[model samples]
Target: MIQPHQHADQACSECTQRLGLIESGLRGVTPVRFNAAGWYRGELRREILRLRLNQDVSVLKAITFALQRTLPAKALLVPIPSWKTQKRANPLPALICRSLGRTTKTLLKRCRPTVGQHHLSRRQRLVNMKSAFAIHPDQQSWCVSATPTWIVDDILTSGATAQEALHTLKRAGLEVRGLICLGRTP
Candidate 1:
C-alpha cells in the first residue's frame, strides 16, 4: 500500500479532504508550496506557466521526478485538458506522466473555455467548469482501463477541476481511482 507522503506527523486538511472526495484505490504525490513571500511564494505559479510554454523540458523533468516518487508505476494517467486557444497547449500533468514512464492519455477536450479560477469560490468553480470537458470519440478507448487510472493536474486548490474531470470520465464509462497533483495551493 502507498503510505501517506504528506508532512509525516501532520496532514494538510485540503489534501485529506480532496483524497476523500476522489475516493480510494490510488495515491497522490505533490510537493509543498513554499508559502512565503516573493519568488518562493509564486514558484509553483511560475513553474506552471513555464510548463505550458513548452520551453523548459529540463525543469519539467525535475518536477516530474518529484511528482512520481510516490505513485505506482502501472497506473494510467489522464491529464485535464487545456483550452483550445492556448498557443502551445502543453500541460504539465501530461508531461510529468510521460516523464514517469507511465502510459499517459489525453482523453478529454474542452467543450468550451471557462473563465480563470483565480477569483472563483468553490461552488462557482464547479459551476464554471461544468460540462467543460468532453471525451473525443476517437479517444474513448484510452479510458477503458482494467488497472486503476489517475486524473492529474498542475495544482489542487478548490478541487473543482479535479471533480469535474473525474465526473466527466465516469460519464465516459471510466472508473477513476484517484486524483494527483503537483502542488497544493495555500
Candidate 2:
C-alpha cells in the first residue's frame, strides 16, 4: 500500500548528475523514492515494477500522473528497450510512457543482449550498456519530429541505460530532451 508523496515535484539533482545530463536538462523527474537496500520499501518497489497485480498498476499510474505535469507539451516519450530482444521481454517503460498520455514510441531496440544492471557497479553498468541500443529500423522515418523527446522508464539507477538510449536517439537525429522515470534510487 504505497501512497503518493505530498511534497512538490522536483527533479533529483543527484540523479541528473549521475545521468550526466547537461545543466538545466529536462530530465530526472522521479516522484517515487526508492531504497534498493531496504527491506520494506525495496520489496514494494520491486512489486510495483513487476506489474503483476492491479495494485501495482494503480501505484504506477498515480506516479505517472504526477510525472505527466512536469513534461513539456507534446513531448515524445521513448521507452528504453529491455536487454532481452523479445518484443515484450520488459514492458514497464512502455507502460509508463503510455501512462504519461504522451506520444509514446518504441523507437529504440536492444542491439545486443546484456546482463542485468542491478548487481553491477556504475562502471560495469556503463560497459554493459555500451552500444546496447539502436534505432528501430521500422521507426526510422519517425525520427524527423521537432517534438522534444524524453526517455521513459520505471526507475533510474546508474543511468547507463538512459545514457545509451539518449545516444542512440541523438545519433538518429532526434531531439532527446532527457529522461523521465517513476522512481530514483536514493
lDDT of 2 at 159: 77
Worst 10 residues of 2 by lDDT: 31-40
Instruction: Give the best candidate by TM-score.
Output: 2
Question: Per-residue error at 70 for model 2, in Å?
Answer: 0.7
Candidate 1 lDDT: 0.61
Q: Candidate 1 at residue 87, lDDT?
A: 60
lDDT of 2 by residue, 1-186 (tens): 444435423224443233332333234333212111111235435654556334355445544554676678788989887776565466777777766678888899888989988799999999998999989999999899888888877667777887888888988899987777655665
- CA deviation > 4 Å runs, candidate 2: 2-47, 50-57, 85-88
Against the true structure, whose lDDT is highest?
2
lDDT of 2: 0.66
